[model samples]
Target chain A: MGEFELIERFFKRPARRSPLGVGDDCALLQPAPGMQLAVSTDMLVEGRHFLSTVDPLRLGHKALAVNLSDLAACGASPLAFSLALALPAANEAWLERFSRGLLALADSHGCELVGGDTTQGPLNICITVFGEVPAGGALLRSGARAGDDIYVSGSVGDARLALEVFRGRLSVPAAVFEAARARLEQPTPRLALGMALRGIASAAIDISDGLAGDLGHVLSQSGVGARVDSVSAFGLLASPGIPVDTALDLVLSGGDDYELLFTAPPSASKAVQAAAAASATPITRIGTIHAEPGLQLVDRSGAVLMRRFTSFDHFA
Target chain B: MGEFELIERFFKRPARRSPLGVGDDCALLQPAPGMQLAVSTDMLVEGRHFLSTVDPLRLGHKALAVNLSDLAACGASPLAFSLALALPAANEAWLERFSRGLLALADSHGCELVGGDTTQGPLNICITVFGEVPAGGALLRSGARAGDDIYVSGSVGDARLALEVFRGRLSVPAAVFEAARARLEQPTPRLALGMALRGIASAAIDISDGLAGDLGHVLSQSGVGARVDSVSAFGLLASPGIPVDTALDLVLSGGDDYELLFTAPPSASKAVQAAAAASATPITRIGTIHAEPGLQLVDRSGAVLMRRFTSFDHFA
Candidate 1:
């Protein structure tokens, strides 16, 4: 079948939620009145962002999930998104599985598939998501302040552990590897937690490029430093079989964790915890924002640990 | 320099118009109250949509321009857009020219550069543009009705004429080739024309995949047919030096003109003309919508010509 036929059969859906959908040159959306639209775009390439053998179904899920994570960072409610896909060839089986996976997640979040383009080329998936937030309510990196308590929702380092196994640089038990791989392949966006923390959290960011590096963004933007508890950070790892020493490195520097890392005033600690429980996600207070301008890791004795903020840089 | 530094030096701009811009996880936009958001995405692969020999500056402009064309078809005013770029390397010179071209057109249309992702891969550019139109005012392809006068804005076929020369299948005079080449590389998005046609147009579409094939979309969706003027379509060709026969073929099926094609009632002809005059874009009556469900082309003798509606299909 032709490109148009493929899209009609697989990607096209009724514009029930949106004002218009796939058939038009442009899709129409009516954002809630008085709310500001939040927009973000993310692109994932084969081999660079995923394994060549990944399930197309899972790939679709991850593609939308990653962009949703950005919305969560901004405390925005999903409205709609567009997909720009480049494929080597139109494989029906792959398209079927991929669309099913993508549509299911999209429906769950009420994020309508608004519009997109499909072209012939190397496999690449780019999604631009639209969302909404109340004016002045978006949690920004520049809002973090000294004396704010930094926290992370959900476990970190599991995805990194999975990457190590995929790279053949480390070995783990089969069950452990499978669990870690799931973390890497299918991350749940902390949408609920993010929305809940909007009025409570001072600043927020989703962890795609490791906790240390992402938090560094908050620090740089807010003109503050961080004093992280290395032991507490490593203790938050989900891998019970792996020793803390090894997990510590992954927890500190490895990437691909979609956890929400945020800061709240010391007074709002209870609210932060309540937001976590409300979202059914765990919250860990691993660091504190400080006036100094460098990220410092400290052990229980309060001695600083040597650290370098090394996150995944696509060009690097 | 790191990713953030590169972005700052090259892409960072003062958020003059958008509610919030580049540094955030998601850019925020406040659409005018009661307006619907118009969104579209298009991706350009290095070897697919454009040639390696084309100027990087023009390539950047075309990438965003194609998406803007979609908004124009919808009769939406330009708002904001995000860019998802995948590059083989972070070449400073190429990026400098690219950003310059992209930002210049965006500025011209008052479209803001919002948030997006950048990574390393085969060179690819994906842009998601957002716009706004009054509720129920968008000119859609499905609104064409029987007896509506079909019209095309500006010239056609020049881009296709340029493509033939690039393919080395034909050659023209140096000046003629340059003019055609410019059309191929930098065809204007008829944004003002589209916005002006808002209440006057019964249905509208952008000529990305040639006049005949793209108009088929209006016919198919509207459940009507069209009787096109073959002579007038050829006359609309901008290639003054090209032969009529060659121009006829190019105007009919060559892609990437980025012109607005629409239908209006005979009663609204005066308004359509007025809109064209206000927008400073020429409008040509090329066809009429019919009750039947097939696109029909007729010569000066008024005998129907067989039309297959062949357009650019990515997987074809």
Candidate 2:
């Protein structure tokens, strides 16, 4: 099939929230009055973002889910998305499963597939997502203040554990590996939790490149330091059978964890918990923002730990 | 350098029209209260979209220009754009030149670089552009009616001539080849002309996959037919020293010509001319939309031309 037919058969859908959808030169979006549009884009490539042997369906879900995680960090409600895909070829079966997984997630979130471009090339999935956030209500990295309590939603480091196993660097039980692999392949975007924390959280970010690196952005942008309780954070590793040091590294510096890492003023701790409950997502407080200037890791006894862990860098 | 540093060095810029720009998880856009957002995405892959030896600067410009062409076709004023790029490596010199060309065109159009993703993979540049049009003012492909006059802005087919020359299929004079290559590399988007013709044009689309195929969209969407004047369209070949038949084929079915193809009523002919003059972009009357259901080509003598032309299809 040609590009047009491929789009028509796989991605085209009737206009929903959008004024115009696929098949148009441009998709027209009418954001409700008084709402600002939140936009984020992510490009996933084979062997870098995903394995070549990955199931197409999971790849599709992970592609959109990762971008939605960005919107979630901004406390935006998913609205629409455009997918620009470069496939090696138009494989009907692969497109069928991929679109099914993609549209299923989009339907669950009411994020319409508006428009995109498709061409022949090395496999790459680029999704640009649009969401809506009320004016002055978006959670941002620049909002973290000293005395804020840092929290993370869902488990962390499971994806990294799965990656380690795939790379033959580690071994785990099949059940543990399967669970971790699922987390790596299909991450749940914390849209509900993010929107619920809109007015409560001072700063927020999705943990795509490990908590240390991702939270570093918030700390740097907000001009604050952070003291993460390593013991508390280590509890977030969902997979079993790993050394404490190795597990701590995965939990703190592992990538592909789509959980939300956010902060709220200590006074708003109760409100943060309420938002977490309302969204049906668990939250764990693991750190504190400080006026000082660097990230520090602490043990259960509040003693500083001397170690360094670098985050994932594609070019490094 | 790391991905974060690379973005900071090259793509990061202070927020302009957007409430938030690069460095944010999601960029926040506050569109004018009464305006509708027009979004479009286009992905360029090496070898398929451009020659590997093409200048990085021109490649960057073309990547965003093609997407902006979609917004222009919808008669939307440029707002901001997100670029998701996958590079094989972080080459400082290439990124510098590429970003310079990309941002130059963006600045000229008053479009800000909002946010995007960067990763290590086979070279791919995906750009998602956002624009704004007054509510109910955006042009569309479904508005054309019988008896509407079809029009196209600027020249066409020069890009195909350049491609053919590059493929060693046809040869042209040095000056002609240079001009044609420029057309292929940096075709001007008709944003001004499109916005100028907003109310006057009934239906519109950007010509990327040649006139025959792109115009086919307008006809199919509007449920109408057209009688294109072959001789008149033949005049649109900006390159010289090409035979009439070959030039006609290139003009009618050449890809990568980012010109605007639209329809306006005969009653709006004067207004269309005024719009062209206002935008300082030349336009030509190529045909008339009819109630019949197929596109036809007629010669200078008004005799039907018996020629079959196929437009570019990536997967075909």
Candidate 3:
């Protein structure tokens, strides 16, 4: 079949919720009055983003999930997304499973597959997602204030622990490895939590590049300092039974958590707890923002810990 | 430097016009009141979409230009775009030139750089563009009727001619080759012509995959047919120093001509002419929509020509 026919058979879906979807040169999205459009794009290449042996369905889901994580960080409600994919060849079975995984999450989030281009090449999936938030409502990295409290939703470091297992650097029981693998392969974008925390959180970012690095972004943008409690943050690691020291390292500096790292007013701790409870996502307050302009990690006794670990750098 | 720092140093700009730009989890765009959002995406691979010898600057420009052309087909005004790029390594010189070309075109069209991801991998660029059109004013393939007149903006076939020269399949004089090469490399997305035809044109599509193939999309979507005049279309080929027979084949089915192919009611001929004149892009009347449901090419005496050439099929 031709590219058009292949898309019609596989990617094309009913444009019920969208003003227009797939088949047009450009898809139409009629935004609600006074709402602003939030956009983000992420690309995953085989061997770089995932192993060649990874499940096609999980890969497909992760492609869209990563972009949605960006939306979740901004407190935007999911609207729609476009996927640009390149394949070495047209494989029906692979596409069927992949689309099934991708569309399932999209349906759950009420995000339509708006439009995208698919071509023949080495396998690559690039997803650009569009969401909407009321004007002046989107959470920004620059909104953190000196008195804000730092929090992170969901347990951290399981994804990195999973990668370590995959690399044969660690040994784990089958069940523990499965749990960690699921964490790496099927990250949940904290959409509900983000929407719930919208007016309460002062600033937010998704933790893709570990706590230290991702929080560096918030500090640099907001022109403030942060003192993360190494004791609390390391204690929050859910690394699927990895050794304590290794788990601590992963929690502190490993990447691919896909959890919301945010700041809120110190007095809003109860409100923040309420927001997390409403979304059914657990959150832990691990630090406080400061008027100083750098990041520091503190021990349990409130003494500064000086051992530094770099964030995951794609190109260092 | 890390990927995030690389983006800040090279790709980040003032973002004066956007509601929100880089350094956020997502970029925010406020659409004009009473307007619909138009979105399109395209991905380019190194060896497939362009030659390894292509200029880095030109490659970046072509990448964004193609997505803009899709917006043009919908009669949408340029708004903003997100870029997802994967590179083998961080090369400062290459990035400087690429961003220069990409942002230069973006600035020219008033499209801002929104949000995207950068990673280390095989060189690939995918751009998703957002635009706006009034409700019910978008030009769609399904809008064409049986009795509409067909038109194309700008010249075609020169891009294919340049490809042949690049492949060493054909040779041309130095100056002639340079002119055709420019047509291949730096295609002008007929944005103004598309906007001007918003109310006048019955249907529209950008000719990325040649006249015969791309026009067939319009017919299939509209449930109509088309009969292109081989005499006029072949004559319209602006192949620099190419032989007549080669030009005929290229004009019939050569891809990568980012021109607009459109249809309009017969009575709107004057309005179509006015659009072309106002946009300063030449237009040619080369065919007619028909009740039959297939494409045909007619000779000078209106006799059907049965010869066929396939469009560039990604799978093929």
Candidate 4:
């Protein structure tokens, strides 16, 4: 069978309640009353985003997780999603494993697979997720105000280190190798943390393109600036076996962390602390928002550690 | 610069209103109050969906049109979309033309380019469109019931004929060539008819994979069957210079006609007729829903037409 036939036989199925589903021009979805929609799209390519040798399940998981992370950045609850998959040919085994991985994450997140398209080409998977937030209550990158405190959930650089091991450039301990690989393959989306921060955090974003780069988006959009403590940012590097200097680089420029970086007004500091304390997620205050329009890194002595800004650039 | 960097340079731009625009994990959109959402996705691959020599502008238009047609089928007003583009290399002129075509259609349909991903590979373009509909008012494929009259807006088979001509296997008059080629290159999405059908038609779908195949979806979904009058269906092909017999074949299984195929209850016939008259969209009653389950095409003499149930199957 050709690619088109494969999609017809396998991917096309009836939607339980969607007014206009698979065969229509578009799928119709009705959101719960009083909720605004949160939307995100992510694309994964064979060589650029993942290796061809990677497990189909992990690839599917990562694909949905990365997009879900975007929803988390906006403090939106996952709802539904559509996938557009392009592949060289129909492989029944690969489809089974890939769909299993995708459905596993979808079930956990309460997101339904509402619509999608499948085609023939080099392996490329694009997922667009739809979510909901209370009307006028979504966490926005444009909401960060000067004098707000900046926080990051969990540690960064693990994904980058995993990439190093995957590239065979780093000889890591077996335990560390497995842990880092897991982090890269199936990073958890900070959905609860995002929901918790909705009212308290003035602005929020996920660190997909490294903390420095993603934070820059918030700074620029909010018309504010930041002063990140380099020493505090690199604290995770001190964890047992990681090289401090290399870890520092990964922490700054590594992409695909999927950790939420947010800002809260001074009055919300207590609430932020309490929310972080209540959750299983780790939150760290790494810096503060500034009135000036630029990113700065400071050392322990408050000396300027870096004057130039750096982060992952997908196109660069 | 790398592929990712190229995307940022050309495709990424600042949006004044989107709370979460490009460079963030996701986008937060506030649809106008009291409206539900319509979502659709489509993927196009080189050598599969279109020839390599096809104009980039037409490619962009067709890609976006396919998704918009989905929204149209749902009777949803267009809102915004995300694009995932895969290319072999950076071609400035081609990109310019492609974007122009995409933007032109988006502007015409009142949809915005909100977020997207760009990567390097064999040429493929996937677009996901979001639209808005009044709550509980979107059209669906499963709503068709026995005794509902089946209708299709506009003539079919021109697109398939154009492809035949493109492959140099068919030759026709200049007028036929021009009309068919236009239909192939820029198939019009029946947005007006769809909007009119909202709450009036029992079930609806856009005819992308020919009337027989797409209508089969509506029949299967609604748990009903249909006996389309082959002679009446063929009458739609009587326009200009096309022969009746040739048109019948095109109408039956020649896909790529982005027309609305719907089934309306007898009680709504007057309303459907009035709306079609007011909107000037030709609405042809080709068949009627049946209690049994299967699709059949009967000639004037009541003989079953010998035809295969095949259209564009992504997997095939």
Range of the 10 consecutive residues with the lowest summed lDDT in candidate 3 chain A: A230-239
Clashes of each: 0, 0, 0, 22
> Which residue pairs clash within candidate 1?
none
Candidate 3 Cα lDDT to native: 0.87
| lDDT for each residue of candidate 4 in B169-208, tens digit (9 for 90 to 100) | 6667777778887787787888878888888999888888
lDDT of 4 at A107: 81
**lDDT of every predicted structure (CA atoms):** 0.87, 0.90, 0.87, 0.80
Each model's TM-score for chain A is 0.97, 0.98, 0.96, 0.92
DockQ of each: 0.83, 0.91, 0.82, 0.60
**In model 3, what are the clashing residue pairs, if there are any?**
none
Judging by TM-score, tell me the better candidate of 2 and 3.
2
lDDT of 2 at A43: 95
How well is each residue in A87-135 modelled by candidate 2, as lDDT tens digits?
9999999999999889999999999999999999999999999999998
> Which residue ranges in model 2 land beyond 4 Å of their true spot?
A230-240, B230-240
Task: Please provide, for model 4 over A15-113, each residue's C-alpha lDDT reduced to its tens digit, 9 standing for 90 to 100.
Answer: 654444555556777657787778888888888878888899998899999999988888888888898898787898998789888889988987877
Which candidate leads the pack in TM-score?
2
Error of 2 at A117 (Å): 0.5
